[model samples]
Target: VITSENQLSFLNVTRSLEDLPVEQGNDAEGLLNECKEAMDHLYKADVYQSFDEPSLFIYRIDIRHNGSIHSQTGIVGLVPVEDTESVQILKHEEVRPERSDLMSRHLVAVGASSSPISLTYKNDEQLDKAITNCTSNEPVLMTEDSEMKQTIWKVVGETAKELSELVSNKILYITDGHHRMAAAEEALKKSNKNYGPLESTLAVLFPDDEMLVLPFHRRVGDPEGRSSQDLLKAISAVCEIEKSDETTPERIGEVGLYLDGQSHKIILPKSNGNNLVDQLDVARLQEHILAPIFGVVNPGTHKLIDYVPGPLGINVVKERCDKDSWLGFVMHPLKIKDLMDVAEAGELMPPKSSYLMPKPRSGVFVRDLNREKNIQ
Candidate 1:
C-alpha cells in the first residue's frame, strides 16, 4: 500500500507493473504535485482502502535476466535508532547528512516508503532451512520478473519464530539504502517533538551468501578537451602500460585504455600498493594512472577522464570514448571477500563502486520498521 503518486493505482495490495510508470528524476521538482495526485487518487479509491493501523510483512524479489535469476525473502520492519549501531545491524556505505535531511523530509511528506533498503547477512543453516520450510506451502502473492516466476509468503507464527531465531545472533549489512536509513535517523532526530527512538523506520534483510554484489561501471564524460595521447602520457608516468591492439581488457587489475582507436592494458607493477586501499585495482589505477598522469587529485572532478567497470565490458567503454575524449578506464571486479573485509573494517568504498544485483521491489510487503519480530 506504499507508492509514489505515479504508482498510487497499484497501492491497494496488488496491481500490474504496466499500470504506471516509475517515478523518475524529473519528478523530483514536482513533489507537491505528486503528493497532491497521490492523495487525490487515494481519496477517490477510499472505498477499497484500509489503514486501520501500521503493520509489517515479508517481501521477496525474484528477477531473472538471461540465465541469471535470484529469489530473496526477508521481513520488513522499522529499525529503532539504537538498533543501528548495536551490532544487530551494519552499514556498508557512508551517507551524507544533507541527503539524509532531504530524504527525511520526503518520507514525512509521503508518509510511506516506496523503496526498501536492502540489508544482507551471512546465512545461518537454521535460517536457510526455515525459509525453505515457509515456502513449502503456496505463496500469498505470485509474480514474474521477466519470465521468472516469483512467490512471497506471509509469515506470522512458527515461520516468524524460526527466522527470528536464525538471525537473532547474526549481524546484518546494508547493501543499499544508505539514504533511507540515514533519513530515518535524521527524521527521528528532527521529529523528537513528535517521535521517539522507536518511531519506526523501514528495511528488508537477507542472507549475504544468497545476495549478489555486482560492479558499478563508471561512465566519465566530457573530459574538458583532453586528447588521448596527452592523457596516456600522464598515465604512463604512474603505471606500466602494456600495449595491445584489442579494444577490450581481459584480466584483473588491468585497465583497457582506448584513445585514438587503439587499446592498451595499463597494468600496475606488483610492488605498487602495500595496504588495503592501495592494493585495490581501482586505487592502483587511480594513483598510478588517473591521478599522476592526468593531474587529477580527485576522480570526481577529473575533467580529463572517466571510468567504467568490468561488467559493462569494453563495448560500453568504447562507446563513451569520444574524439575529444582520449582515455577510458575500466576496473576489475571487486571480490566478495574483499567487500566483506571492507565492511568488517567499517570502511566505505568510493561512491557507486559496486552495482549490486537483484535489487528488491518495494511495496511487496512494507516493513513498518516498528515490529517486534520477523516471521521467516
Candidate 2:
C-alpha cells in the first residue's frame, strides 16, 4: 500500500519525469531514460519478487463508502495482445493518440508493467465457485488503509489451469485502462518480432455483477465572463431549471448544477437520436447544456471543461467552484447494463463517462516482459 498520506504522490512521481527543460529538445527520450533509470534502481533495491513457477493470483479489494462496503474479486494474469484486435476483448472509450504513444514508449523502456488493465465479463456460476474456493484460505499478502483493504492469494498447478480454462472462451469488456491496452498494441505493431513477451500484457478480470460504476461529473469555466443569472437564463431556454436544496442528482434525467454558491435542478429533455450513447445523461448534458450554452463542443480536450469523479462527493466540486469561480454539474451514475449494451452495439461512450471504483492497485503484481512466459 502507498504509505504516503498525500493523494498526489503518484502524480508527483510521474510529473518529475515530465518536468524536463525545454532546451533539451528531446523531452520524450529524456523521459524514457529517466523511467529506465528508476526501474533499474528499484531492481537494485530488490523491490520485486518472482514466483517459482507459472501461477495466477486472486485479487480482492473492499472499499468502505458511506457506511457500506463494496467488495470485488478477480483473477490476475496476462492477456494476449492479439485479443485487443479481436472480438474477444471490447473497448467502449476512445483513446488519445499522444497518451497512447507515451505509454508505449514507457512500457518498452522499462521492460515491465506495474499496472494491470481491468476487464469485466458476464457472471458465470463455475467461475464464481472457483474464485470462492480460492479465496477461502488465508491470503498470501494483505494490505490496507483507511478507505480500502486489499488481499491476494496465489493459485498454481491444476487449480490455476482450471481457472484459466474457465475464462478462456468468455468474451471480456474493457472497464478500465483503455490507454494501456492501446499502448501495448502500438508497441507490438512497432516491434519486428511477431511473438514474445510483448505478445501479452497484465490484466485482472472481474464479473460484471460485482463491478461498481460511478458518475463522472463535469466542471466548466465560462470564457465569456457571463454571470450566473445570465448563464441560467441561457440554459433555461433548452432545459427545465429550478433552484434546489440538493447538490446531488436523484435520477438519470436530472442534473444538479452548482453556480454562484447555489444549487439548481436541471431536468433534461429526451434525446432525439436513436443510438444508445445519445440516450445517456452525459450525452444529454453535452448536447443540450455544454455545447449550446458554454460553446464547449468537444468536452474531451476543451480548455474550459474538466471532469471530476463522483466518489469525491459534491462538496469537493463545490469547493473547487468556490475557489476557481467555475460551475459544477452533479450527474447520476450509469448502470452496468447500459455500458454492456453500448459496447455490444459497437458504439463508443463519451469521454470520461464513468468512474469505476476499487481499481486494481499498481505494484501489487509486476510483470517482467523479457523474462516472463507468454500466457497465450
Candidate 3:
C-alpha cells in the first residue's frame, strides 16, 4: 500500500503523478499534461538511461520475512500485446474499466513504463538452471532496504536469446498488472500504427514455484446497525459457525471471522462439481455472506466493504474494528496451481482475492516507448 507519505516523498523526487500539485479545478486532461511535462523534464535531465541494443535483464528480489529470506528471480523484457488475444497470456482477475482507462491515458501521456507487469509460468528445469547461472555472476545493479534487496543483471548475446526462446512456447499467467495489460490494449486501439512500442508492454516473467501468493482479507461495515448476534445468526443460516481461537483460516473451505471482538470459525459447504470460480473462498464469502446478509453484490464497488492486505497481519483488521463496528474475515491464501487452473480455463476470480508479494518496484528499469520498436 502506498500511503500518503510515500506518495508525497515519491512526488518530491520524481514530480510525476499522484499527489503532485496541480491548478485548482484542473481537469483530467490538465493533469495528464502536467504528467507529460514532468516526464519530459525527467527525460531531459537524464534520469533514465537508454540501452543502444535489444537486451533482456534478470531481476531478483530477496525479501526477509518471518525470520527467513525468500528469493524470486525472473527475466524482465517486453511481452507482445497480441499474446492476450492469442491466449498465450491469461488473466484471472477482472479490472474496473475506469481504472483501466486511466492507466491507458497515463501510458499515452508518459510514453514510458517504469514498472513491469508481472507474469508467471509453469516451472521449467532448463529455465531455472539458466537463471541460476546468470545470477551466479555479480549483478550490474543492486538496491537494498531493511526488509528487501533487489538485484538486476543484464543479459545479452546468445544467452539472452536462449532465455527468450525457453519462455517463448510457455503459456504465461498474469500475477499482477491486469489493469496495465488492459490499458496497453486500449492504447494499442487508439494508436492506428501496427508496429511500435505500443505493440508490447514491459513485463517480468517468473516461475510459479518461486512467486509468493497471499490472501486479501475482507472487512465490512454494518450500515443497518445490526447487532453482532444478528449478523452471526444470518451467517449461520448458510455456514456452520463455531467459536475458535484462530484469527486466520488454516485451510480452504474454512474462514476466520472476527466479530464483536471474538474470533469464530466458519465452515463452508462443499462446492458443486462445476464452475471453478464458485469454488474459491472469496467467491464463497460473497455468495454466502456478503451478498445475502449485507446486500453487497459487487464487492469491488461496494462502499461499505474494504480489503486489507494479508501482509498487514490480523492486528490491522482488529485495529480497524476497534475504531468502528465493523466485522472482518480472514481468508486462506489461494494456491498457485488453482490460480493457474482458473486462468487457463479463462475464468475470472473475485476482486481482491489474491495478494502477490515481492512485487517489482518502479524506477528500477524504464522503457522508452518512443525509442522501442517491435521487430517481427
How much lDDT does each candidate structure score?
0.61, 0.86, 0.85
Error of 1 at 96 (Å): 3.3
Better of 1 and 3 by lDDT: 3
Question: Which has the greatest lDDT?
Answer: 2
TM-score of 3: 0.93
Candidate 1: worst-modelled 10 consecutive residues by lDDT: 367-376
Please give the lDDT score at residue 88 for candidate 1.
Answer: 64
What does candidate 2's lDDT look like per residue over 9-47, in tens digits? 333223333366667665887777766666666666675
Q: Root-mean-square deviation of each candidate, in angstroms?
A: 5.9, 3.1, 2.8
lDDT of 3 at 340: 95
- Which lDDT tens digits does candidate 1 get at residues 152-252? 66666665666666666777677888888888777777776364422555667777776666554544443345666666666676667867886445676
Regions more than 4 Å wrong, model 3: 1-26, 373-376
1-376 per-residue lDDT for model 3 (tens digits): 3433443222322333445455535365666776666567667777566777778999999997667999999999999997899999999999989878877888887777877999999988999999989888788888899878999998889989999999999999999999999999999988875647888999999999998999999999877889889999988998999999888898999999999899999998766537898899988888878887898988999999999998899999989987887999999999999899999999999899999989998767878677664332
Q: How many clashes does each candidate structure show, in the order listed?
A: 12, 0, 0
- Cα-based RMSD of candidate 1: 5.9
